[model samples]
Target chain A: MRFAATVEVQLRPGIADPEGATIDKAIAALGIAGVSEVRAGRCFRFTVEAEDLASAEEVADSLGERLLSNPVIERHLTTIEALG
Target chain B: MSMRVAVVTFPGTNCEHDAIQGLEAVGAEAVFWWHTETSLDGIDAVVLPGGFAHGDYLRPGAIARFSPVMAAVADFAAQGGPVVGICNGFQVLTEAGLLPGALQKNAQLTFACQPCGLEVAQTSSVLTRGLEIGQHLEIPINHFSGSYVCDEATLASLEANDQVVLRYRQNPNGSVANIAGICNVAGNVVGLMPHPERAISPLLGSSDGLHLLGSLVSSLPAHR
Candidate 1:
């Protein structure tokens, strides 16, 4: 099965996120309304070949820990897409 | 006798020669220790120089933590000896668990290489003896994974122990609390993202790093 993975990365607390603040300012300028907070982060979407959703999640977790994300300031969350 | 220092060289370490020269300039007996070595005999301090060890493969400092040279460094620190890890060396230290927290990628997803200025938060450790709290200095930092981070409970402990050594004046990376450097629980091991050796000479447009290296020499006992 072709499993889709979405990984979100965020910096730890007390860490300065100037880039994130910049993005927040830019989004606010658009006057989109109702979006009070926005933190800058990395989003990676990829397709993995796996037997099941759990297997895909396992691969996604390994990728985040080993290559896609740094476990230090960046905490990665993986979500496997539900079958359409 | 002067202090005996060893510069451990892991595979892919490009800053070994520069680090050795920096130590030699200040009259420390600097020797190169390969990653394959197990023992660092007769050395008062061990410096893990900044470099792209293991090509930063398997995550920064991931594979290098188990290197043969790191075992020697672990033992050296256990004996109350001073250990300094700069840049990639800092990454290795975190991976090896010699220090707390870990280094993450820049939030902007850029490889930042530039002069980094920081304020010293504490100076009781062997690596920071010559600095003053809130004192300013410059060092050149070149790396992608330089963001320092830890959990809340650990952060509290670091603050309580006065282990936070250096903090970025103007944050270059999204490091937790702008923490550029920190020490171990016992204050013997220090790891920082900036390359102090790179700023030791004015020819590179900065001599502020001399304070960091100089502190190591100055902290030595009269007999060491």
Candidate 2:
């Protein structure tokens, strides 16, 4: 089976989100109202081959830590969906 | 009378030449080593110069850490051979798990390029042995993601072990604890954001980097 996985990575809260802050300022400059905040992160989408959804999730979880996101600064969440 | 230093060059690396010239000016024979080569033969020291290795695809140093030469570099570091990573090289070292912490976007959210003040926080590492603790240095920093970050526990450990080598006198990049550089527990590996090779010549603005590079040379094993 093939699982389509999306790994979302973001800097931990309390860490300075300079890029996000910059974007927030830019948005404010555009006269957009009610925009309370903005934060920046990256999303990695890939397909993993495994026997089942559990196995695919397991593989992605390990890869998310080792290669997708650095645990030192970024936290990651993984979502896996089986593909036909 | 001279040490052999290998400056590893990844595809996008642009500072190896400066590193080579700087090391040679300081009485070390520096050579360029391609990232594909997995050998450190006759090398007394290794340098990872600044650059966008592997186009910094995943993150600075993330992709480059898997390069073939990195294994050899890791082994060299394990054997107590001095290894220093400058700028992007520093990022790679952290990504490779050779050093603690990680480099994030500068707190100012801009690419900073200017001379910054540094304080020697440690004197026992291969990268700073020539200097006394609390010494001041003016070195150039040129990077967007140079902010050093680590967990509280790791920061405490870094301090307890004296692994923190350099601290920004003014904290230019919002690094936790003002950490500008750090060494591994073994003291042979060091990673920092400032471009020491760029500070070797007085004409280039300052000669403070010579003292740092000189420390690496002097820390080498006898008869190298």
Which model scores highest in DockQ?
Answer: 2
Give candidate 1 regions above 4 Å deviation: A1-84, B221-224
Question: Which candidate has the highest lDDT of all?
Answer: 2
Please, what are the lDDT tens digits per residue for candidate 2 over residues B1-224?
68889999999998999999888877898999999998899999999999899999999999999999999999998888899999999999999999988999999787889999999999998989999999999999999999999999999999999999999999888889998999999899999999889999889999999999888887865224
Chain A TM-scores, per candidate, are 0.78, 0.95
lDDT of 1 by residue, B1-224 (tens): 77788898988999989888888777788899889988887888888998888888756888898788888888778877889999999999998889988887676757889988889999987778888888999888898878777888889999999999999999887887889999998777999988888887889878888788878866763223
Off by over 4 Å in 2: B222-224
Ten-residue segment with the worst summed lDDT in candidate 1 chain B?
B215-224
- Scoring only the second chain, what is candidate 2's TM-score? 0.97
**Top-scoring candidate (TM-score):** 2
DockQ of each: 0.22, 0.90
Give the distance in Å from residue B27's predicted Cα in candidate 2 to where it truly belongs: 0.6
Q: What's the lDDT for candidate 2?
A: 0.92
